[model samples]
Target chain A: MSEHQYPASLTHGLSREEILNRLHNRLDEPRYEHCLRVEATAIELAKRFDQDVDRAGLAGLLHDYGKEIPVETYKRVIIEDGFDPDLLQYGRGVWHGVVGVHFIQTEVGITDKQVLTAIARHTTGDPEMTKLDEIIFVGDFIEPARSLPVEAKARKAAETNLEEASRIELENTLTYLIDARKLVFPKTLLTYNAFLTKE
Target chain B: MSEHQYPASLTHGLSREEILNRLHNRLDEPRYEHCLRVEATAIELAKRFDQDVDRAGLAGLLHDYGKEIPVETYKRVIIEDGFDPDLLQYGRGVWHGVVGVHFIQTEVGITDKQVLTAIARHTTGDPEMTKLDEIIFVGDFIEPARSLPVEAKARKAAETNLEEASRIELENTLTYLIDARKLVFPKTLLTYNAFLTKE
Candidate 1:
């Protein structure tokens, strides 16, 4: 793949076709399909929430770009990027979103801070998420491929009340993590606290 | 109430009768009964875990001493004692444990830091909970009057593995708070993280 296969600009102005082409080469077919669904869901959410649809779509398309990387390579990227050292204690499930930021910046040449923040926090969520952040976060959870029992209610809630939908999704995710005996990254708790207290 | 009704010394050598007398005057009948159940549960856990039964019982008896105080009085105590200002943002559900420490210290004259820390953290756990802290925290949840479905599993786990019991209790509490749309105190998250990463 030539360097031109990726976006040439930092503003994330690439069309959907160009973004898909780049993602297609980087991810296998099934994973690539998930990204497309996430992008479509994110755009719908953005429209409902009055956020910039283009940035949401871009964030969704590129959210899991680092998931395909080798674990050792992701570890190196996490250290080189100067993320919180405590992040090293978690596994790939938590690392992908964080390490994805560095991968997108270096490999995909997408540097929009809002887009980067959305990608960085898409999986676990940050305490202070913007409307765009909520769009991508909720969209990734309720995307078409997801089949959790709560997804239908979450999708409906997303259309009517984004904050409530986000809160429910966070609660569901934290419950799953605890039941599975997996480590929960601290930012997920911070995000839950933020939504729990929101007006 | 007479001054002798409260503990006159810092060592917490007050007899169970004395403690019950003080609690009876301060709390209503049902609340006072709940404290008695907690004390009983705590002593049983302490025996299983090889901790000080007397200290655990004292911590349990005084755990909710501030619960009966008026909300405005607890708020005043919180600020006057220089507790975390962020505590002001949370409602009474989160205040009583924190403000109770000051009331216990000033009114009851019990200055043992371990007992105070256990009382302060009983409602929402601290990250660095000792065996004694775990006894009180789990005991309060699995006490007889508490009939939550998870409490039985938690009680059994407390007898076998205190850490596992504490983790289960925290997960149950956090899930309940989230489902009820209540604000989760940050320390609760810290305790969850600590347990998630423990061996």
Candidate 2:
């Protein structure tokens, strides 16, 4: 409770490719490439933040690891596997994220808490954004390949101050999700909220 | 994904006492008691479904294990734990159910995927529930302690037809969450939505 208390998946030091190989074809070719792009973006942010590039890259690379399952299977797996299916029903598809973290650690045998924590949190980026977690999150949405108008500013911030860049990217992400009437993953808002307070 | 993968923390298999002990120290004393009561409720539901009461009981007892964290910590852990905060902001406090599964397996080391899944989905029972998952979910909400006008009927359904009873319970629970201005966890609604399609 004092620090980030996590198990193997959250902390193991798996490289991006190692994590991708561990994905074991869960993702199709396109999604895998997207993850690879996200990992690259995350690495850029990591350099800016002076964070662990490997951890950030891995987190970005594996953010959607559980997403390969059809939405229906998500619920089925949660029920059959004995997880809460409600997570699958809602916004930003967190059940996969939650389940992905577990799968990576237990099934894949990666035990680096930092890497897992980054993956666990990249979607909603927590209040206390560890350098790596923030990088992976912002990098996910604003990587060079992304075509968002906000990316330019986000890119600029990443080159200067990472926390500020993450804050901007997260707020923008929340705005997009909210405007879309999408289920705003609370952590995204929480990340935004936390950023607001910090700023 | 094919056979339902769970982590070693989840598959380790814990005794009821160990489960309670973990909950007792981490959660409010009353909530701990609620867990025990849910176990009994789950046992009765197991009877209705002709499922394994012991596994149902264990799942019921630990459904809200993550609820033990103080609100601040719960907020932080779940968000930092990687759940999209957008999901949380929808006013669904029920996330602990999903988050609980992750915690039990990763941190607590109870690895039975089914057990963790059952606990995760208990708040918003899934549609394709395992015989065991359904039993435990029904038990958690309608346990002898819950006080609702339809509680008696729900209990009887556990005796007569579990699937039917679950359909009713899920309906009422979703309505209650909606009425209370709470965000419905998608998985719960998916379960409810899926059941709505069936007989």
How far does residue B16 in candidate 2 sit from its true spot (Å)? 4.2
TM-score of predicted chain B, candidate 1: 0.90
Location of the lowest summed lDDT over 10 successive residues in candidate 2 chain B: B1-10
Over 4 Å off, model 2: A1-199, B1-16, B90-92
DockQ in order: 0.59, 0.02
Full-model lDDT for every candidate = 0.80, 0.66
Give me the displacement of residue B123 in model 2, in angstroms.
Answer: 1.5
Give the lowest summed-lDDT range of ten residues in model 1 chain B.
B1-10
**Model 2: interface root-mean-square deviation in Å:** 9.1
DockQ of 1: 0.59
Range of the 10 consecutive residues with the lowest summed lDDT in candidate 1 chain A: A1-10
Model 1, C-alpha of B48: deviation from truth (Å): 2.3
